[model samples]
Target: MTGLGEDVPQTAGAIWRRTVPVWAGLTALLVATLSLAYVPMGRFGIVVSLGIAAAKAGLVVVFFMQLRKPDPLLRLTAFASLIFVAFLLTIIFAEVLTRAPPTRPGTVMPRSAPDMPGLGQRAF
Candidate 1:
């Protein structure tokens, strides 16, 4: 009678089989992200880049962290943490977008000051 807590011995081959595809996918995503940086897409560039990043992060969390296992508590905790992060990002974005633009200088300086009799001219 094996308990749920008992560790199952997995062969190296089994581990490799599961992880190889994930590694390849992550590598592909990395290449895509780097390539996207060079191609200018204006405002949509950030959206696409962030989407790829989120996908990469999801793969890492699910496979590397072994979050795919049937653990209700673990999944719930992960979900809660993601929600908190989303909330924080929303607040930060709101603050940044709502801020006023900086004020520009009223007047530009002249290359040389006008020669006033008492100002620049020194009486010897």
Candidate 2:
């Protein structure tokens, strides 16, 4: 009998049969992402791109990473990590959207210093 944690050996054909469909699906998602870049979706583009990216990430995690058959604790850890990243990203985007815009050259009116003498009175 095989010991604990020992994986059963499989033929090359079996491995290929299992993996090829996942590879093809990943390729399709990649192509969709590339094709989306040229479309003018205004504010919705980021959402669409992120959705595709999440799908790609999910496939990789479930298939290549072999997370599907892991212990419950491992799955829980991965889920917690994903939640933490989402929380961080939410905070970051909120801060970015709510912060004041920076003043660029010509955007603000020129003003003389209060302590300066005759600087404001001089003609340009």
Candidate 3:
């Protein structure tokens, strides 16, 4: 029994049995990520790579960090953090998607531009 009077398994064998599958799942995810990199998906590759990384991170957090254990405050904190991150990412994505594309490739202006009223030389 746990300190909270819960009948959670405290045995080493039970913990090992639970953690081993998580480790194997993480390894499989790593292999999938590496293999996907070789495929020529172009723009979609970024989404796939990020998705795999998020999966691996989730496994590490839930299993290794033991977030699934009976602790309401800890679980609420984790959920709130995830929500905050999602909100931030949504704002960033919206800003990026709505921006206008650059018209010129470089900073230097064209040679045809007139000089300033007082200055005779071109600004370029």
The residue-level lDDT of candidate 1 at 108 comes to 38
- What is each predicted model's overall lDDT from 0 to 1? 0.83, 0.83, 0.84
Candidate 3 segments whose C-alpha is farther than 4 A from its true place: 1-15, 42-47, 98-100, 104-124
- lDDT per residue for candidate 2 within 1-124, as digits (tens), equals 4332347567898789879999999999999999999999999999999999999999999888777774677689889999999999999999999866657554544455774457456432
Worst 10 residues of 2 by lDDT: 1-10
Off by over 4 Å in 1: 1-9, 97-101, 104-124
lDDT tens digits, residue span 1-124, model 1: 3333247558898789989999999999999999999998999999999999999999999998768777778789999999999999999999999866545465433334454346566533
Worst window of 10 by summed lDDT in candidate 1: 107-116
| Clash list (residue pairs), candidate 3 | none
Show the colliding residue pairs in model 1.
none
Strongest candidate by TM-score: 1
My TM-score estimates for the predictions, one after another, are 0.66, 0.62, 0.61
* Candidate 2 or 1, higher TM-score: 1
Report the C-alpha displacement of residue 106, candidate 3, in angstroms. Answer: 12
